[model samples]
Target: MAKTKKSARATLPPSIGKVLKRLHHPLDVILLCVRWYVAYSLSLRNLEEMMAERGLEVDHSSVHRWVIKLVPLFEKAFRKHKRPVGKSWRMDETYVKVRGQWKYLYRAVDKAGNTVDFLLRAHRDKAAARRYFEKAIDRNGEPETITVDKSGANLAALEALNADRPTPIKVRQSKYLNNVVEQDHRAIKRIIKPMMGFKDFRCARIILAGIEVMHMIRKGQMQDDGIARNPAEKFYSIII
Candidate 1:
């Protein structure tokens, strides 16, 4: 069984569990499906086979259903637990395939690796960039200068924001500056593959948000526990 911490809600909205439990498969089965898929980054089919090995027969479609429905719920709960990103944000987007179609997910992370904002969209056009900016930058009060991978849409949005602002949003672009966000993404890619080819923007959003939170936890970036030890002790603890 995967380790689970009770969310603040104590229970997910009844509507979420009610619908999933209505299916013939039990909630434990569904939880097992979600945990394996999210925690281990197993694909839908892989989840099916893993469960079957333990004598629990399930189909990929059921696996997908479990994920698709629960993603938003997880997204909702995950946000409440994320640490503050504060300022100095780096942003980027990657293309992924979903059912043979392409979509974009724009994400930003602060200097300390805290995820700043994430948006899932069908396209990576100027308009999409604007939408992300209006919601992302506007809500948090402006961060100083923004760094992004070279994308004209990003430049356009930053330019527009600057022009509209009396101070002009400080804007800077550099190829190397985006390495942190890219490294963070690689950590996520190492785990999941359905995202190796995303089927839709919605799925991308759900999966990426969960990943950001997980990454922080694994790296010991959340609140510190004050456990101090020599490097050798830490190494053995991790290996064991």
Candidate 2:
């Protein structure tokens, strides 16, 4: 009998494995589409034209599907690599229209201009503010100080949360102090403005996640190098 040799098998990371099934396009091509979609303000139609110019025939709907399906995977992979945010944070809420109805987008950023987190809500009251604050703290840990405008809802939420802590987090109500996070909103706003508005809330949330992840990547907040030498490779390496 001939001797039998054993062969080693390659494994895919869970994050990428889930998305690899039923994916027909090459990994590089998929990554390029995703990168352009999120990293730039290009619309789906624009991406379709650009891909056509490159000798690749892909529909805008396909690009939209890629963004919807892959963004969560990318965000999960990138979360493991994010740098610890600064101790102080600036928090604010902005309005976004979904299906012609206005919704609140609660966003927070550290003093260094790195995004902490964001949430979409139907209201901008104390309950909504508390929910946003709780989610941000849970994800990024509690900040030493939070700067906000004198929104009563925000102040109330801080007070409610502080009541339970042995050492309360400081809240600074100053319009000037929160300029960093306020200005940080422009990147996301610019992306959304081009699309006019999302058709539904779920779709809005999914797309927003992808957009924010791209913003974080561009800001050099998602890698050990503090800057991705090759973004495509860096993104692809997350799963492979």
Candidate 3:
């Protein structure tokens, strides 16, 4: 009787039980939609139509709700298992439109082109750059060197951080060295271009994070414990 009772329990991971508790759809179905949305360039309506063809009637609004609710959790989980990046860094900022206004997305990649961290801010000044550096350093530890383009704000931010450190970080300003990171931005920009722009800042931040997480997964950034076979498997592995 004990063996039968144990076997009858749901096989879903306990960590996500509370998150998906009230959802009517099966776990695989919900996660598939979320994964497809972020990993590919599919919109909510596109996912809705795809699911409909599979004989399931899921609305686009519900999928949007799922993304808004679950993506942050997915990001949190991904961070815990993210692999350490190289010490030499390349940092840059890109433009993201939120509410018809341009916001700055600060992103960094290691010397090997692995993503270090990303932050979105409303401004492109020294203060915004400093905050992004602080967040990245807090999560990823100090880098030996950071190469940036001829951005005064980025230079100022690194200078401010160096002031508080015992060993100063080497700062290099070269448009050519930063080309790797600038080229990396295209993968993210390509996915978001179809959406035109984000409706609000909060949504933009969350969705952008989801996209980054997927990008990281594609680059084999997550420490998968040797269990996942591909990017999709690696993505689903993070939640468990």
Pairwise TM-score winner, candidates 1 and 2: 2
The TM-scores of all predictions, comma-separated, are 0.76, 0.89, 0.93
Indicate the residue-level lDDT of 106 in model 3. Answer: 96
Summing lDDT over every window of 10 consecutive residues in candidate 3, give the lowest-scoring window.
Answer: 1-10
Tens digits of per-residue lDDT for model 2, 123-240? 8899999999999899899899999898999999999999999999999999999999889999999887777788888778878887887787678777665544665556655555
lDDT leaderboard ranking: 3, 2, 1
What is the overall TM-score of model 3 with all chains considered together? 0.93
| Candidate 3 off by > 4 Å | 1-15
Ranking by TM-score: 3, 2, 1
Question: Candidates' lDDT values, in order?
Answer: 0.66, 0.82, 0.87
| Reference-based lDDT, residue 64, model 3 | 76
Model 2 ranges off by over 4 Å? 1-11, 225-232
Stronger candidate by lDDT (1 vs 3):
3
Error of 2 at 197 (Å): 1.0
Worst lDDT window (10 residues) for model 2?
1-10
Candidate 1 has what TM-score?
0.76
Top candidate, metric lDDT:
3
